[model samples]
Target: MLDGLIISIDAMGGDDAPDVVIKGLEYFLKTTGKQRKARFLLHGDQAAINTLLAKAPLTKARSEIRHSDSSIEMDAKPSQALRRGKGSSMWNAIQSVKSGEAEIVVSAGNTGALMAMSMMILKRKQGVQRPALAASWPNEGGTSVVLDVGANVDADAGQLTEFAVLGEAFYRALYKTDRPRVSLLNVGTEDQKGNAVIKAAHERLSESQLGLNYIGYVEGSDISLGGAEVIVTDGFTGNIALKTAEGTAKLVGRYMKDALQGSWWSKFTAFLNMRALLALKKRIDPSGFNGAVFLGLNGVVIKSHGGTDAKGYANAVNIAIGLAESDFLQTIDVTLEALHDEDDNIGFIK
Candidate 1:
């Protein structure tokens, strides 16, 4: 459907390496069952990959394996790995995309390494100052997008505004929202509460005709409660908000489970409400929304957690396929190009 989408997967990038990664791919192929058509280029040790496949039911017919001799360790410096580990799985995967061998690249690898290799190899789109990592999280309402999660820790008002534009485009394309509500993440909801950068971004958003419903400001609590569909902020604030939300979710889930199991009456209630409880769990499950999409890159790049196992890796692969099928890259590119033109027009008017 997508002209035979090629996904370059770093087989040795995640915590489980080739074993779980390959298993995930196998599961995806079995479950989807001709509903989607795509090829994968698995990059890793050829011998190891073969050995893993030997024990499993996967044949080499559906996908090809590209051998890479080395791997970029999670602890290795991102810049150093990008400079020296030219033949590493991560580097080779990105190179495949750059060389037109692949339409998208997905990895459950080191975040810093993936970001560094992506910025160096695929590079950013034209007029994109810096690429941001936009991740979707399940909120009280449904889901929301948060940008610049950890890509550029220190960003200016222009950068934040760019994130907003990129985020709006992503939401429109993926969620099909008519007018995605964009909000600036801040400590206070007031316009004048944050520092100079935020204030400037608020002003620019208000004055620009970018076709986005730019909500003035949003507090941290608004994230989980779904105050806005698209939240834009610098990497520092965005990363903090993301980690805090994840940690809080885990804590709350654990506490609730423990409290419910503490007494017989509570256990009886839990049994009676098991269906509702399971529904709630599915709503708040982190694994359901595990893929983190790196926006503004020339191609689609999804970064999954290093701690992901077979199921998590499978989820990431599914997300990659969905993105490719949706033609997310082209959608974002066209939207951003329009927004850039609008910004240029505003500049000329002033």
Candidate 2:
């Protein structure tokens, strides 16, 4: 039940603040089938949250409010947010996870701030070189986990290898796909293609006895080709790839809308193909894919797009819910232990 999966929410985060946060929970619990199994701990200004809670009775029914006198602004830098973070809603929400009151934490707040606070409060998992932000990307084979979307801007070979392990954990936990294929995003599919760091990381991955189905290397274009279920790279490169994909999707959508609306004939044809188009639209909708998981952290924390609305925030909440409900963190921990053991075995075999 959802009560067993307590989600701590930062009600004062995001552009829409408590309004969207509360409404999003209501929309999700009311429309979604698993409403009865869910519970929430909302953190923010008591007056404001209560005002909205009155309107979102369903969410209120399943939630307990925790008030905070302060809040970090949307424009504050991560460092600034950290300095002013005490007793803030975001801080309190994360504190709930740390205190064991909530299994997961969700915030549509500043990404940098959220990550910084998470690392500080929840701390990093042992042997995790760096935390990675992973998102589910729509691909031909289905949704694939793409990591380092924005956690660390730079990474060495060892750090990149760590990301692969984290990526594998996410794919296994969420998708439950046995032996998920992993890949390194590079300039080309060729083994020799990329910087020294990537090449070095590729070598380790290829030789890894960690049970990863490493597929050598995949180019940027290969990301959506369904060749790999998990793509690992430095945060700098991954962030660009993610933004590029988002921009391209938007550009294509705009062009299509213009083309379909330009002429009466086009409109008639659009109407004829409306059902198919809507299905495709639903499958690739941005709102449906709003959440990104912060991998390699000790506790579950989901970062939602700061500008997202209720439905988008709900999607983000769903990601936090999913990870909390699954053996995600446990899977990563277990995989790391097994990886170390396998490396020893591989060495002995050699």
Candidate 3:
């Protein structure tokens, strides 16, 4: 039976599928600590998921299994998965969103396959030349929205402007921010530093009366310095920056751990400052922002980290719920129509 808000889940898509998925759902229900009326349509191998659900009373109560023996592999190519992914857990989860059986879909499956299937199934929202993936980035001020993070490797001027639109709406939806500052990522903040595509996109944003807080260009260092609330770029550059930041966080964590345990004095100081250390850890933890959204889609789909724990998965689920409850899609549609109208007036779309 359908309940309050239905979330479709690819239960067998993650690295620790079924087990982690069930535990994550349980954590989401328990931690919310309110009268949440959310239910789940879990698509996966019923036998495996049932075994886990037997232990997770909260999740079992809220989730229903849509049995599918097949699942997409972590390393499977998008093309291959597309050819043979029918009836798979990932496929069914997306299908639920397409068929209006669920408000949103969550998957920790192969990114390529997930994006491919989402595009094929849900298609693109009107006025969108191409869809972009947006990620929640932890920064000095707070979380910033960065796109197109590995969705479209190369975006032209028009597509880059579209990313700005998509990212602005996304930042608002996720963080409840009003009038998020949008900026283009480039080598330098100066107008002449970027290539032709970047310059063209910048010109368009600056001239458009789309009501965006279109700030100028921001460099890599500015990303963590809260240079702008929404940083827009091509997927090639954005993906590299994302990976580099992730790796650097891990490296810093390792270094901190080593220094904290190097000697008795270090250990004593670490113990004495345990509270601050934990606060710092929580601030930098990637799991706190685990959901990557494939924006500009007809339906909402969240891509959770494959290796994330229960906490990370819960964060993703929370994002899905928040979007489901908001008028995010309508806002996007209205803004996109404005952008298209403006573009058409100046022959920008041509």
Give the candidate number with the greatest TM-score. 3
- The TM-score of candidate 3 is 0.98
TM-score head-to-head 2 vs 3, winner: 3
Root mean square deviation (Cα) for candidate 3: 1.1
Residues 282-325 of candidate 3: C-alpha lDDT, one tens digit per residue: 98888898999999999989999999999899999998998898
Q: What ranking emerges by lDDT with the best candidate at the front?
A: 3, 2, 1
lDDT of 2 by residue, 1-350 (tens): 24567999999999988788888888788665255476899999999999899998888778898989998888889999899898999999999999988999999888899999999999999878679999888888787778899898899987888889999888878777888899999888887699989888888778876778999888787676677999998899999998898888889888988998899999999999999989978876788888899988889888888888788888888777777778888878988777657546655221
Poorest 10 consecutive residues by lDDT, candidate 3: 29-38
Q: Which ten residues in a row have the lowest lDDT in candidate 1?
A: 54-63
* lDDT score for residue 11 of model 1: 90
Q: Residue 315 of candidate 3: its Cα lDDT?
A: 90
Candidate 2: the clashing residue pairs are 1-37, 2-37, 2-38, 3-37
Judging by lDDT against the true structure, name the best candidate: 3
After superposing candidate 1 on the true structure, give the runs of residues whose Cα lies further than 4 Å from its correct spot: 1-3, 30-34, 55-61, 263-274, 348-350
